[model samples]
Target: MTITQKIKSLPLTFLLLFFTAVNIFGQKPNIVLIISDDHACQAISAYGSRLTQTPNIDRLAKEGAIFNNAYVTNSLCGPSRASILTGTYSNINGFKDNISYNFDFNQPSFVKALQAAGYQTAWIGKMHLGDSIPQGLDYYNILPGQGQYYNPDFIRSGNVQKRYTGYVTNIIEALSNEWLDHRDRQKPFCLIIGHKATHRVWMPDLEDLGSFDDKTFDLPHDFYDDYATRKAAAVQDMTIAKTMRMGHDLKMYDPADSATFEDNIKRMNADQKAKWFAYYAKIKKDLDAKRPEGRALTEWKYQRYLKDYLATAASMDRNIGKTLDYLDKNGLSKNTIVIYMSDQGFYMGEHGWFDKRFMYEESFRTPMVMRYPGVIKPGTAINDFIMNIDLAPTLIEAGKGQAPAPVQGRSFLPLLKNQHYTARDAMYYHYYENGEHSVSPHFGIRTKRYKLIRFYKRVESWELFDLQKDPHELHNIYDEPGSKPVIADLKAKLLKLITAYKDTEAAAIFARAI
Candidate 1:
C-alpha cells in the first residue's frame, strides 16, 4: 500500500494515540513559574509606576513581553492559585475564598500534564493552597500556611517541616537554586518559585531596611475618596486610614511593648532578632517623637506602609535576578520559559485601601511578564484580556500539549505570536470572601472600557463605570440618567458569560438582580 493508503487503513484509536504522543514530544520547554503573593503591578517600574524601581523585573519586560491587561478570576490568594493550577474559575475549582478549605489535589493540573509528558516538576517556597502538598509534584518545599517573613517553617518533600533561619525571600531563592542544581538534567523541568514577600505584614529583608526612606511617596489621587455614590466602596473596611493598623500592618509596634511583634520575631535566631529589633527600634522612636494626630498620622502610616512594602519587593526583584542568572549559567536560558506574576493585584493605597477584593483597576489588574528567548519578542506589550485561569492552558499549549476538556481558560499563544490577534472581549470575576475586609461578596464583568458589578451578599448594590471616562472607578454610574443603555448591555453580557462558563450560582443571582 502507498503511504497515504497505509495511514488511512490504520485504526482510529491508534491514530489518536499517535497524535497525542507526537504532540507531547514535539516541544518540551522547561517552564519556571514564579508567583508572588499580593504584589501589585503599580509597584513595578515596567508597569509605569514611579513609586519604586524594579530593574530585575524590568529586565523580563525588556527582554520579553509585558502584559498590560492581565487579571484574575478571583482577587484573593488561594482562589487565584487554584484558578492558575486547574485552568478553571474558583467556582469550578472549589476554592472560592481564602478561608480554610482543602484543595482537591486529584484534579487535572497542568503540572501533572507536564509530568506525564516526561518533565520533572518542583515547587519551592509558599504554595498557600493548604496543608497538604498537591500530588504529581516531584519535590516541594512550601510554607505551612501564609508563611512567615523571617525564619519561616517550610514543609519539605515527604511532609517534613524544616525551620530555616533567614529572610524568607533569601531562603526561597537559595532553595530554588539548590533544587535547580539537583534536578534531573535528563528531562525538561517545571519549577514554581513562590515568593512570600510583599504580602500582609510586609516585612523587609534586614539588608533592604530603610531603602525607601529618602523617597517621598505620593498618595493616590483618590486617597481621600469618600465613596460618595458607591455604597460598596464606602462600606469596605480595608482603607489604609481605618483598617491598616499601626502595629500589625505598618510594623510600628514597639519591640519591647507589642507582644505580637515580640512573638513574631521570637522564631528568628539571635542575630536575626537582634537586627530586626534594632531596625524597628529606630522606627518606634521616630513614631513616638513625631506623634502627629488625625490625617497626619494616617499619612505617616501610608508612607511607612509603602516604604516597607517596596523594601520587601526590592528583595523579591533581586532574587528574580538570581534565578535568571542560574538559567544563563546552565545554558538553559534558550530553552526555558520564565514567567513572573502575582497571585492577584494589590491595592497600593488606592482609594485609601491596602488589601485586595474589589474589582477596581488597582486590585483587579495583575502584572505578568514572560521571557521565552525565541518565541516571545523583546519589549512586546499585549493589551488583550488574560486571566489567571488562562495560565495553565497557556503552559500546556507551550509544552505542545492540549488543554483538558474541563479547562475554561483559552491560551493566548496566538497573541504572543501576533500582537493584533484579539482575545476575550470581556472577563468575568467573582469574589466570595465577604465581611473579611467589610467587602461584600460580589461578581462582575469587565470589558475593555466598561465594568459592571453587583455587590449581592450583604447589600444589594450595583456599580457601573465607564473605564474610558472614569479610569479610577470613582463614580457609581449604574443609576445615572444616560447609563441605562450601558447597564442593560453590560448586564446582558454578564449573564451570557455566566451561562457560558457554567457558573450556575452566579447565573441565578444575576437573574434575580435583573
Candidate 2:
C-alpha cells in the first residue's frame, strides 16, 4: 500500500497529515487589505458620490463584489479594527476605545494566524490597537495613536519612533513598496495598508488644497434632525455649529506680511503676526467676500467637507492604484484577493451628524468590496448581513482552511460564490457608552426589511423601523401596535444572539425586556 493509504489507516498519522494539509491550504491567500480611517462611504464616487471622483476606490468595487449590507460589530475605531483582526467582539478582545489601551495579542489575530500558517504578514499605516505591539510580525510600520497629515512620527519596529520629513501618504507607501519588493516571491503574504486620512480635524496635503476650491456641493435633506426623537441625541458633544473650531476651520488671518497688526492679533510678535496673516490672508479674504445663505451654508459645509476629505481619498486612491498596477504588472491579480473597506461607515452630513456612533443606517452600513479572480464575480452585489468579524473566516475559507474556534461570525464565501445564498436571517448591532463622547449605549437587530433598537440603562427607550417603508430611518415606530409581533420575534432572536455572542449587557437587556 502507498504511504498515504497506510497513514490513512493509522489514526495518529492520519490526524497529523490532516492537520498539516489544513495548515497548508488555510494560510495560502495573499491578502491585501486597504483600510481608511473614518472614511464616509457616501464621500466615495464608487458608492454614489457625485462630487468626489475616486476612480481607484471605484475601480475596486467595479472589479469586485460590493457588499451593500456590511457592518462593524462595534462603531468606534480601535474596537472595530480589533474585531476585524481577531474575529472576536470588542468585549472579548478587551480593547474598546481609541485612547491608550493594549490589544491582548493572545487571541489569534489574522496577522498571527497567517504567521502560524507560514504566510508572510506585514502591517503598515495606522495600527491604533495599543502601545505594546507583538513579536513575530514580519514587518510593522504604525502611526502613533492618531497620526498627522504632514511630518508624522511612525514606529518602524517598536522602540524606534522616527519623524519622517515627507508626507505620511508617501512615507507609508514607500515602506509598503519596499516590503513588497523584499518579500519572498514564492510565499503568499498578507499586507494590511491602513490610512490615517479623513479622520477628525480633516487636513489635506499641500498639493491638494486648490483642487476643489471653485466647487459647491449640496447637503442632505435632514441636515437638521430634531433631537425630540431620541433623548441621548439631545445631549451629545458633536454639533457643527458649536463643535467646529473657528480659527482652525475658518483659516482667518490678517491681509499682509507686515511687522504690525491693527489691534487684532494678540498672540504673536510683529514678525510672527505678519507670517500668520500672510499664511491665511487669501483664505480669509475668500471667505469674507463670499456670503453663503440658507442651503448655501450647508453647501459650503459640503464643499469644505469634500475638498478636505476627498484630498485624502485622492492621495490614498492614487497609492491604491499604484499597488493595483503593481499587482497587474507582477501577474498577482489572478491569484490574489484584494479588499478595500473602512473601519466603519462615516456620515457625510447625513441626519446632521459628522461622525459615526448612531445606530442609523449611515453609520451601520459600511462600504465593502471584494476582488478575487477565482471566486467573486465582478460588479456583483451581495445583500448578505455580514460583519467585520466574518472577514477572517471568509478569507480562511477561501484559503481552503477551517477558521479558528470561539469566533462569533460566519464566513460569507458561499455568498461570494452564489450571491443568492441564505446564511444569516438577522444582524445584531450594539454600541457601548465609554463617555469619551456622549453616544448613547444601544443594541439592536437588523433583518432584511426591519430594524429594532433598544436604548440601555437610561429611559428604557425602543425604536423600530420598517426599512421598506422608511429607507432613510427618519421616523421611529417602536410604539406602533402593528410591529408588536415582529418586535417580539426579533427581540427573542436578539436574546438568543446575545447568548451566543456572549454579549453580557445585551443578554441582560434581553432578559429584562422579556
Candidate 3:
C-alpha cells in the first residue's frame, strides 16, 4: 500500500467509524431519571403550589409532559423504589415496607434488562433499598438508609463508604455531572439521580437557610380535620402537632440538651456548623420569647416545618436545573429523556399529617414531569392513571429494552407519544407498615371518581370517598345511605384488582371480607 493508496482509503475508514458510532449510541434515547424523596406536588409551582417556587422542576413541565395523575403502588420509600425498579407492586417485589424487608437484588429488574441489552446504567445517591449493592448497574453510589443532609456519607461501588463534605443535593449534582462527562459516549446510558432533600429533619443548604421564612404559609383547609368516620385516620401517629419533635424536626433546641440534634449536625465542618447553628439560634430565641401554646404552638411548628421543607427543596430544584443545563449545553437534550419525580407524594399539612403511608391522596400521588424532545410535546398535560410501577417498563421501552414477564406495570410510553392508550379504570394501592407512624396495614383501589380504602388488621373498617365532590377526602361515605351500589361496585373492582395483581394475601383478606 503506497502513501497515495492509504490516503484514498482514509475516507472509507472514517465513514465506517462514523457508522459504527451511530449504530452503538444513536439507536435509542438516553434516560436521566431524577427521583427526589417525599417531594409533594403541592411544593412545585408547576403543580399549582402557592407555598414555594420550583423553577427548575417547572422548566421540565414547561418543556415536556407533566403527569397530573401519577401515583405509586406503595407509599413508603423502599417499597415504592422497589416497585419502580421491578415494575411490580410491593406484594410481588417482596419489599413491602422499609422496616422489615431488604430488596432482593436477584429479582428481575428493568435495570438488569437494560444492562443486558447493551445499555450503560448507573444509580447515584439515595437508594434506600437496604445496604446491599443494587443490582444491574455499571456503577452505584448510594446513601445509607435515609442518608444525611450535611456532609453526608455515600456508599459507592464495592460497598465502600465515603463522606462528601457538602449539601447532599449539591454533591449529587456534582457527581452526576462528573459521570455524564466521563461516561462511555459510544453506548446509550441511563442515569438515575436520587436526592435526599425535603425528607424528614428538613435541613436546608447553608445558603438556603430560612429561604421561606419571609412568607407565611396558609394552612390547608383541613389542617384541623377531625377524624369523624375515618377510623384509620383517627389512629395514625403521623401528625405535625404530635409526631414532629421541636428539637429534631423544627430545629428548636437548647444547645445544652438535644443529643439527637447534635448527632445529626456533627458531620458539618466548622464553618458549616457555625452558620447552621447561628441561623437556628435566632429562631430558637424568638420561639422562647413568644412561648406559643396549644394551637399557636402547633401552627408555629407547621410554619417552621414548611419553611425548612421548602428551603431544603430549593436546593434540590437548583440542582435539577444544573442537570438540565448540562444536558442542553452538551447537545444531549435532543436525544436524552429527562424525568423528574418524587419517590411518592408528601403531605403539606393535608389532614394535619407530616409523613406518608396512607392511601390518602397526598401520599398516594407523586409529582412526575418528563421531557423527551421529539416524542413528548412541550407543555403536554398527561391525565392518565400512571403509577410508579410503570416507570421500569416505560424507561425500558424508551431505551429499546424488554421488561420481564413477571413485571406487572404497563409501559406509559404510548401516553407520552399521544398514541392509542387505554387508561386503567382503577389503580390498586397497598401499605404494609404496621409500625412507624402507627399506620395500620391496609390496601385499596383508586379510580377516576372514587377511592375505596379498607383499613385492615388493627383498624378493620372501610372508608369511601367521592373524589369529585370531596377532593380532600374529608368525608367517608362507605356506609352512607344510598351508597350501597357504589360500595358494591368498588368492592368488586378492588377484589378484581387484587386478584389481577396476584396479591394472594390481599385476595385472601378480600375473600374473608366477602
RMSD of 2: 7.4
Worst 10 residues of 3 by lDDT: 254-263
Question: lDDT per prediction?
Answer: 0.87, 0.74, 0.90
Which of 1 and 3 is ahead in lDDT? 3
Residue-by-residue lDDT tens digits, candidate 2, 1-514: 9987976787897789787657644546688998888887787887777768888888888898788788988787888888888788877777766664678877777666667667787888987788776553788888878776666788876567887655677778888888888988777888888888767656565566657777766667777877666666677656554444445443443444232232223424456445445545666566679966555555565556656677767788788888888888876776688998988888777666677877788888787787887577788877768899998877766655456786677788777777555678888778775465567778888888888888766446788888999888877777777878988888888887777788886777766742
Highest-scoring model, lDDT: 3
The digit string of per-residue lDDT tens for model 3 on 1-514 reads: 9977875678887968766666545678888999999999999999999998999999999999899999999999999999999999998989998889999999999889899778999999999998666889999888899999988899888988899988899999999999888899988899999998879989998899977879998999999999899988999898999999988888776555655346567777889878877899999999999999999999999999999999999999999999999998997887888999999999999999888889899999999999998789899998889999999999898888878999999999888877887888799999988888889899999999999988888789889999999999999998898889998999999989998999998888777762
- Estimate the TM-score for candidate 1: 0.93
Residue 58 error for model 2, in Å? 1.5
| Candidate 2, superposed: residue stretches over 4 Å from native | 1-27, 249-280, 289-299, 400-402, 419-421, 457-460
Give the TM-score comparing model 2 with the true structure, all chains together: 0.86
Tens digits of per-residue lDDT for model 1, 1-514: 8988998999999999777657544558899999999999999999999898999899999999999999999898888988999999888888887785768888888888888778899999988887656786999999887999888899988889898888999999999999999999888899999999789888899999999999888888989999988888888889888888877777666656655545456687778778777888898898899888899988998999999999999999999999999999987887789999999899988898898988898888999999987679898997878998889988987887667787999888777767455679999999888669889889999998999998887777889998999999998888889999998899899999998889998888887843
Better of 1 and 3 by TM-score: 3
How well does each candidate superpose onto the true structure, as a TM-score?
0.93, 0.86, 0.94
